[model samples]
Target: MKTDNSALARRLGLYFVMLWFSIGGIGHFVATGTFASIVPPYLSDPYALVYVSGAFELLGVIGLMILRTRRIAGIGLFLLTIAVTPANVQMWLHPELYPIMPQWVYLLRLFAQVGLLACIWWSTRPAPKAEGIRNGPQFP
Candidate 1:
């Protein structure tokens, strides 16, 4: 019997990413103030941006579960991660601002974001073409 471990891993990774974002999206609504606080002060209407990002996270989670929309979802999430980087950086720069969280946690989160991006890309990428398969019909 042949087993495709990579496929299985990718499926698991996709599920994990979906769940992570789903919870995060819901948290935006549940803890709106906390999320808003993290937003850089330079941005206008931080609360509105928090909610908007939350909605996008939820939408991306749904889109990720569907094969037809996975690519778009992945791209959206990748962009979202980028969009939120500034907030993470802000937090890192001012550890005293978030007294409850230590500096190391923020540093770890920065690294985790990179891993999350890699997972999104790996899980949502289109399947590779099989060997010898091309534009023409194939025979067994």
Candidate 2:
């Protein structure tokens, strides 16, 4: 039996992302008002949207944990991030609305989402080919 470091690293990355989202989802319920406050003014029913996003986050975490569901989960979470971009934008445009954090933090969060998407894609992608002889080569 042999261990593949790349595969192990991907799995660890997946788990780390899952844990991060799980906590965020739970926070939606625990601090509904805080999450709702970030919703863009144009969106109606901020509280409901917050809870709905929380549900999807939990679902995405479950999907990421299962081997068969990882791809879908990655896709879903990626879309979810896109969907929530409006809120991020709102925060950036109206820093006065969310006084708890400085204006610059919201800008960084937009970039962070891109990194998170890349991590999710890398972690959920198909396993790499095993190290060995190639189709037309044989050594020793």
Best by lDDT: 1
Model 2 residue 40 distance off true place after TM-score fit, in angstroms: 0.3
Best by TM-score: 1
Considering summed lDDT, which 10 consecutive residues are worst modelled in model 1? 131-140
Q: Please provide, for model 2 over 3-44, each residue's C-alpha lDDT reduced to its tens digit, 9 standing for 90 to 100.
A: 467656766777777887899889999999998999998899
Error of 2 at 18 (Å): 0.2
| Candidate 1 TM-score, true structure as reference | 0.89
lDDT of 1 by residue, 71-140 (tens): 8888999899889999999888889999888999998889999999998887777644532223211112
TM-scores vs. true structure, each candidate: 0.89, 0.87
How many clashes in each structure? 0, 0
TM-score for model 2?
A: 0.87
